[model samples]
Target: MTDANTTAFTNPSTFILLGIPGLEVAHVWISIPFCTMYVIAILGNFAILFIVKREPSLHGPMYYFLCMLAITDLVLSTSTLPKILAIFWFNSREIDFSACLTQMFFIHCFSEIESGIFAAMAFDRYVAICHPLRHSTILTNSLVMKIGLVILLRGSILILPCPLLARQWPYCRTNIIPHTQCENMYVVRLACADTRISSYYGLFVLYCRIGLDVSFIILSYIQILRAIFSLPTKDARLKTFGTCGSHICVILAFYIPTLFASLTSRFGHNLPRYFQVFISNVYLLVPPMLNPVIYGVRTKEIRNRLLRLFTHKGTKAFSSGVGPQTDLPGVAGW
Candidate 1:
């Protein structure tokens, strides 16, 4: 778009993302680690998905949210990884303007979905802890499906405009982007027209998203803590803490890196490019890799069920002379 509000990039076809700012290092160095992490992240999240889908004993509102969370992680990992890996491995970071818009759209959509899923998980944990008597009543199949639909609606409506607005912008200026992926603000800053409106809208979008999701998470925990402290038995208190602890850890791990990147960039703009890239990458890779482990490995019940599911599957396959993963255990309560 032109500076005076003219739609400059109206017919733009392609744009280029400058690979990771500046670091004379070879692309392979970046590609290897980045691709490795993406692979690990995808596999880890998918394993959790597999476990949840196969283990019937783990079927419940909690695991249902976990399934959604895993799906979010998968989408989040996939959205940016391919481009990132391509830029790093092949030294080709240029993407079509439309492709950039598509990447931006999916990134925002999935990240927003991630937050929405976390908020849903928080509510699930809160209900299990706070309203044990009515947890099932409140978290029925219909209610969970309704929440899922709300998440889909919110994500699609909030993020669809990003690509639409971006694509409509005129791009007579340089098509150079400083990052591998067309991150919302990064790509937005490249518009020939003033991006004040886009920035405001971006903040509004985030405000609505982060504001709503984080508020629900905090409020859920607030009531959860009150209920836990009000309980009499030490065993009761520990059990309550144990149940919520995994979720708390996962939330902190997910949110803190993001907060660090945002605050650091805001206050430390002078930080080197690789440093910024590294810090930003942490938020992407860490959560996907750690989430399933935090929720499954550290939790006893899910771990036991996972082990049974896998071991039983292996035994059945070996007995049948098929293969290790020939048959999966059915989902809980299925």
Candidate 2:
């Protein structure tokens, strides 16, 4: 209303993130669990990447797609958690305007890239199951490289406009973001100018880009299931199911919390602020923590490799002459 008030709002150089409102006093106490989870996510994903790189047996399409997924998870978690931890530990929540936009860009870009990787994984599964004889020929290293490029381009190009559009709108009232991260919608809501275009474009990207990928993933699974059921013996059916179980679990883990968080943010207007923030963290953090665990447990190769890794480390520490044992079940066989 007054020039003094307008100047006060527009002249602010940095925006403050109100990390988990009403729990400000317990920020330090609450950060312990989050710190532990972040460590696990980073270490677990990195281990997957390392195992795939070192093992010659894992140089196929499935494992390559997995490496891509691990990389995406690493980037996605790193983009959001550092600032959150800083807020909780050191009370550092001030982010410059351009810095905030940069954070927003990477957050959305890597999310889309992760979704695309999931779709690529689904297609790999489909080809392997539906056309076993042709799998190697169809999904060669060259094709994988091309697909990776397309996925990276799709996400980077589509997400570039989101922050660009948001930065054009001027903020004149408050710069306090309610969430820990600089999410696109949360940042756009702070703008005093019309934000209908930004809001609609965000929705468009969600439904058109991520939504299409999800649909194709479901369709690929359906076709794979059809092919598997046509096999003659029960043993064959069980073997096929075993091969796909880990991927199914990973897909469920990623999509369920994400959808729940999106719905809660949109429709749970009467819900407490902390509930919304909790779900948002769950959506962003849970996949990176759980994906490696699922793969290591369900996939025999990864589990054996991890076991050998630790065993070898232990042997070297205790005795220079002793070597790591390889008599574990599923180590010699597939």
Candidate 3:
């Protein structure tokens, strides 16, 4: 009888994604804001890439890292948003088994990579402020490339097991995922077989990667703050703090929603299902949408380059002696 029951297990070839449980009627209205944010995220991240690539002066470790970050945000958001929008708009909820696993992998993997990039950016700020003399020597372009490769490899390796483990589960239960996307835990819970192993493995990977990155980021900022305060003049101190302000804002924007969503998923089962769904969606949408905006508004170099890009006609008039010429060498054609 036991062997017969075990042999009776069947895995569905496709899973249906519920856009948001208990809010099916509002999917269209809800997609408006989500669609808006997704559009902004795409355009903003691409703009960052374009400006950084066009300007040679922005070719330092910081902007290089920013470019990598922009690319990561692009991929991270692109992975889930389009399918989510389709689910919302067309009520297209069916996802193939392999496709679901692929989506799961991309969402989690790039998120970890993005977190690592934040740590890298924090370290860049620390070196630039705390050890100005060594900043140039330490974070050369080649070294930054190596760091990026290591981050990519580490995140990919760590998250690869999640979907692989998930795929091994005997999902004899129903194939309906009660969320917009194939979130690891949500999908794993659909297995009729015991899922503690998969659940614990996912948790273990999350804590180890995110915890290590967070610790490194915190320590970097602590040393950076100390260095900022040690500056003799108030102006120097403020100026130094200003340099880190954008990165700090971006870090908070990224981590706060992520941590909240993570906690809500694990511990806030008593919370409203809709609220949990909302926060999970927010977690994926907000950072990518806000990151480029924060940097464009706060970072002088990037901001100025953006202004130059959009206002090149006015810049041309000014360069013709109608006003002061603020054009730099590499930015002439832009």
- Top candidate, metric TM-score: 3
- Candidate 2: TM-score? 0.90
Q: How displaced is residue 1 in candidate 2, in Å? A: 20
TM-score of model 3 vs. true structure: 0.91
**Pairs clashing within candidate 3:** none
Query: Which candidate would rank higher by lDDT, 1 or 2?
Result: 2
| Candidate 2 or 1, higher TM-score | 2
In order of TM-score, best first, we have: 3, 2, 1
- What does candidate 1's lDDT look like per residue over 264-306, in tens digits? 5446677887677667777877788788877777666566556
Better of 1 and 3 by TM-score: 3
Candidate 2 C-alpha lDDT tens digits along 149-172: 899999999999998998888888
lDDT of 3 at 277: 80
* Lowest lDDT block of 10, candidate 1: 325-334
Query: Which candidate comes out best when scored by lDDT?
Result: 3
Order the candidates by lDDT, highest first — what do you get? 3, 2, 1
For candidate 1, report its TM-score: 0.86
lDDT of 3 by residue, 3-104 (tens): 423444567788888889999999999999999999999999999999889877677788888899999999989999999999999999999999999999
